[model samples]
Target: TRMRPLMRGGAQERGRRAGTENVPGIAGFGAAALEARSNLEARTAHFLQLRSRLEDGLDEIENVKIIAREAPRAPHISSFIVKGVRAESLALNLDLKGFAVGTGSACASGALEPSHVLGAMGYSASEAKSALRVSFGVQNTEAEVDEFLAALREMTNRNGTLSGRSTSHFTL
Candidate 1:
């Protein structure tokens, strides 16, 4: 005779997951996924536009260089290097000013290791260490970009003098 459905079920196979189901969390996840799917295209376009403006603002700053400027990059990600300042220091200063930024890859933060991505793309250790990453979200605006750039310029100038190194001048 065939086994009963409940009896045939493995001990580890309680519904879809091995552990107890989280009904509320699962429902929330489904709702979030649906909303994300609905807004995906429009959100992506907005991010791309913000990223473009951010890049333009950064490019106009003296002594700042963008990594992989010529390469195909994600529309929402902007990575750059400010001449003569450490990435960690820049990130910290930016944080104090209420703008959150990252140094190199998010995974490599606090590791004191240079970015492997920059290394693979032929950036020197110093160049990679000077890198900053700004990921644009749908909520960012042109005014925010301008404010960030102003803060970045002031911080870079201060750090450059303190470090006693010439500002990085990169052309691609």
Candidate 2:
């Protein structure tokens, strides 16, 4: 696995990355990693709080369903489907509103096909079509989440009403 690749010295990294030695990047990454490890508990709590707020907001809106709600998820990510809206359109509208978001999967952004992740999880074509992903970073705050929710509500409501239709629901 890439995350647990054979332990190698700096020289091996240099060879693989094709750089003499990115001392600064390595040092910075190491520091960030340490900080992340140390702050894991607090960071996780904050993320869960924000995620809960986002989910609550989405619940009040019509035709929005939280995908993988019962599944174990990372602290910083939220994926959902907004009925009657396409993921691409939602992403574009959010971008225009100065909020960065992802649709389907990053790798499948430009493709017309539905997300493989959703398909693998048994979402139908229309359900997958309405997918959107929001990943929060350390810099994100409650105010930012509120703002995003407002923007999403406006965009989705203005577009059309959400249809609560699910072709299939299954766990993978």
Candidate 3:
């Protein structure tokens, strides 16, 4: 059996990964994971507090629905729907303002596919496409969420279209 190994090459990662093992990348990931684990309790508390504040701010906006409002959610992530606007458009508009957001399953990012999870949970295709995912890290602050809400509100005003695309139209 010439091809005993998966790739017929040296076991870069003990026959696990085929490509060369990225030491730096792996190290960085491990460091971040350890840091997150070490601060899990405090970070969870902070994220929960921030999520409440953000949800409250979102409530002040019109035509928006907080997904799973009655369901459980991870403290670090939020998914919502901005009625009458495409999630991609809204996400892009916010990203241009120096904010990062996810429009669908993070693993399928840039694929323009509606989330299977949302679809399976009974959201129509159109509604699923309008879903947006926002994640928070320990470095974030409540004030930042307030600012983000302001930008999002302006971007998806009652007109159902993004406001002026210029930096002047949004305050990050």
For residues 120-161, what per-residue lDDT tens digits would candidate 2 score against the true structure? 888988888888888876667888888888877776653454
For model 3, how does the per-residue alpha-carbon lDDT over 84-139 read when each residue is reduced to its tens digit? 77888887778877787877555556666777878777887888777778888878
Ranking by TM-score: 1, 2, 3
Q: Give the lDDT of residue 144 in candidate 1.
A: 84
Once fitted onto the true fold, the runs of candidate 1 whose alpha carbons sit more than 4 angstroms away are 1-20, 158-172
| Cα lDDT of model 1 by residue, 56-157, tens digit | 988777768888877887878888887767877777667767788878765566567898878888888888898888987677787888888787777665
Instruction: Pick out the ten consecutive residues of candidate 2 with the lowest summed lDDT.
Output: 163-172
Q: What order do you get sorting by lDDT, best first?
A: 3, 2, 1
TM-score of each: 0.76, 0.75, 0.74
Clashing pairs in 1: none
Candidate 2: segments with Cα more than 4 A from true spot: 1-28, 158-172
Clash counts for all predictions: 0, 0, 0
Q: Each candidate: what lDDT? A: 0.73, 0.74, 0.76
